[model samples]
Target: MAVEFMHPDGLLQQSDYAPVAVGTGSRLMLLAGQAGVTPDFKPAAPDLAGQVHAALRNIIIGVRGAGGDVGDLARLTFYIVDWVPEKWDEVLAGIARAQQAEGLPAPTPPITIIGVQALFTPDFVVEIEATAVLD
Candidate 1:
């Protein structure tokens, strides 16, 4: 599969992501917003970093279950409650750890992060949704 990123003139060039991503593939996968929760509906981790790791793990699980690999992911949408800009370092670190554990490639998908007041529950801090493609 081939993915292309384009930034039109007059638009700010984002180093982390492109304004548009054009992907060529035969199949598309849209995953639900996965929270950092266990099968028993309990918080998977007590802190933000841990929760982020757990959520990333869930994303890998979902993608693989759909017969897609982490590299197939084309986009990511993250909804965070009471988000702090400084927390990104920890969040990214957690993601890195999860990817390493799962033997997944370093994620380079276009991502959108939204800061919200709350989620489905008080214990939930972050929710991650994904879009993937498969040939």
Candidate 2:
């Protein structure tokens, strides 16, 4: 699969994230928002970094279950409770850890992050939803 990123004249260019992504593939899979929760609906980890990694793992499971790999992901959306600019460090750290553990490549998809006051419950801090494609 081939994915392209376009940066217009005025829009800012980010190294890891792009404002837009164009991809062509044979199949597309949309995954529901996944959080860091155990089957019994308990938090997988107490800290934000751990939660982020857990959520990333969930994302990989979802995509792979759908017959796709990390390279097939087209886009990602993240929701963070009580989000702050400083929290990006933790998020990046978690992503790095996940990439190392899972042997996943750099995130090539366009990603959007949103901040909210709460999620399904107070214990849940981060959730990720994704769209994936396979050629």
Candidate 3:
């Protein structure tokens, strides 16, 4: 618990997540956008569902390598190539699958999703940028 989540009284706060996060850790980690790639930098899956899961898993790997877990994450940004509102369902399903596979806590950090024309490569369908603070 290195962050304080704030959802002020009258700020259109109907969403399940906090709009602001105030962190207290001394060390801050700004992770680069993690793509849905495998160990050898290969695409983990062919579809959005599998790519989303792989991307989240990669975020977890990055955070853990920096001595923190998912709880230490203060924010997450998702960049999806050719994203659409209807694709949100697939995103949710992927996250659920990742949680089951990686045992990641549902941190519910403040988030932003962006639709991009493309990522670093065509193989990666999604990339996730994570911000975390640690002791």
Per-prediction backbone clash count: 0, 0, 0
**Per-residue lDDT of model 1, residues 1-135, tens digit only:** 444556778887765455666778788888999998897889999888788778877988998898877777788888989987988887776677776786544445777889999999999999999888877
lDDT of 3 by residue, 25-123 (tens): 889999999988899999999999898889889998998899888777889899999989999888887777787898654546787899999999888
If ranked by TM-score, best first, what sequence of candidates would result?
Answer: 3, 2, 1
lDDT of 1 at 75: 81
Best by lDDT: 3
**Of models 2 and 3, which has the larger TM-score?**
3
In candidate 1, which residue pairs clash? none
lDDT of each: 0.79, 0.80, 0.84
Q: Which candidate number maximizes TM-score?
A: 3
Candidate 2, residue 78: Cα displacement in angstroms equals 0.7
After best superposition, candidate 2 residue 135: deviation in angstroms?
A: 2.5
Put down candidate 2 lDDT per residue, 21-105, tens digits, no spaces: 6778878788999997776778889988888888888888888888787777778898999999999989887777777886445
Error of 1 at 4 (Å): 6.6
The positional error of residue 72 in candidate 3, measured at the CA in angstroms, is 0.3
TM match of model 1 to true structure: 0.82
